[model samples]
Target: MESRSRRRSRSRNRERPYEITISTADMSSKMQTFIMEQVIECLNNRSHPKKMCRYIRERCNARYGPSWDCFVAREYYGSFAYVPRHLLGFELNGLNFLIFKGA
Candidate 1:
């Protein structure tokens, strides 16, 4: 028999679909193109993950305004196929340690 608290916790842990609201205006073609290009450049140049994040943030801020979040850039970086899953979590000296996995 499960404890009442445990049952409640289990219910809470159940995954549920949720809607995320994002402004369509923020996702313009130009913005998408810029993010894609930046992500590809970072991968090709073998940039540190933190550096890539900073670069994207800076560029976005310059093009947009300070009101814009860096989420778009981060999403692009996270989806880059060339980067390994494990490498994403490892950071040293405020920068990601570059590690290439077998292709």
Candidate 2:
């Protein structure tokens, strides 16, 4: 299997494009794209990681039923318990993000 995470440009002169390297995921392609969009949106909004996690979680629950949650950090190491096929892990910029829907 091939991971199609685009070759991100190393230019800091302009805004970084929406690109992520997904490490582990069990979500649909559509939802995966949505996560990317949310990350970019939150980053552009200059939101703090905690606030960003809450915003993303709320947005996700609003769109995809409920029980959504998110965590963002530079070096993330934690346990997770979530609904099947509703978990995603990826890296954006230098942050590690894990978002999931719990029972």
Candidate 3:
């Protein structure tokens, strides 16, 4: 059986056209679900903090394509006066911890 890494490498050149129409409600729910599941999976499966951060950041980039920075800024940066303290590994509560515990 081929490994996940091999599968990903094999698709490096596949240019998929962007044609999916997502409503605002659907996009919001889908992004939230995708983020939560990926974050949980990375936290549970990864053994290092940096690795987990990279995993999530990469997932965001892949999911949003060229607009990842815009999404991150809107979802995480622009709304806050400063970078969230939890992103620096402070003790946080509930889903906040799950979202921001890593680097």
Best by lDDT: 2
Residue 2 CA error for candidate 1 (Å)? 37
Better of 1 and 2 by TM-score: 2
State the displacement of the C-alpha of residue 90, model 3, in Å, after optimal TM-score superposition: 13
Q: Which stretches of candidate 3 lie over 4 Å from their true place?
A: 1-27, 67-103
Clashes of 3: 0
For residue 99, give model 2's deviation from the true position in Å.
0.3
Q: Which pairs clash in the backbone of model 3?
A: none
RMSD of each: 18.0, 4.0, 14.7
> Could you give candidate 2's per-residue lDDT for residues 26-46 as a string of tens digits?
888899778777777788778
Give one digit per residue, the lDDT tens place, for model 3 in 56-100.
Answer: 667766765422311211123223221222221111112222232
- Measured with C-alpha atoms, the lDDT of residue 72 in candidate 3 is 17
Candidate 1 per-residue lDDT, tens place, 7-95, comes to 01111233432222222222334554454455445555667667776776676556655433333233334432222221212222223
Among residues 3 or more apart in sequence or in different chains, the pairs in candidate 2 whose N, CA or C atoms overlap within 3 Å are none
Alpha carbon RMSD to native, model 1: 18.0
Put the candidates in TM-score order, highest first.
2, 1, 3
Off by over 4 Å in 2: 1-15
- What lDDT does model 1 reach? 0.37
The TM-score leader among the candidates is 2
lDDT of each: 0.37, 0.79, 0.34
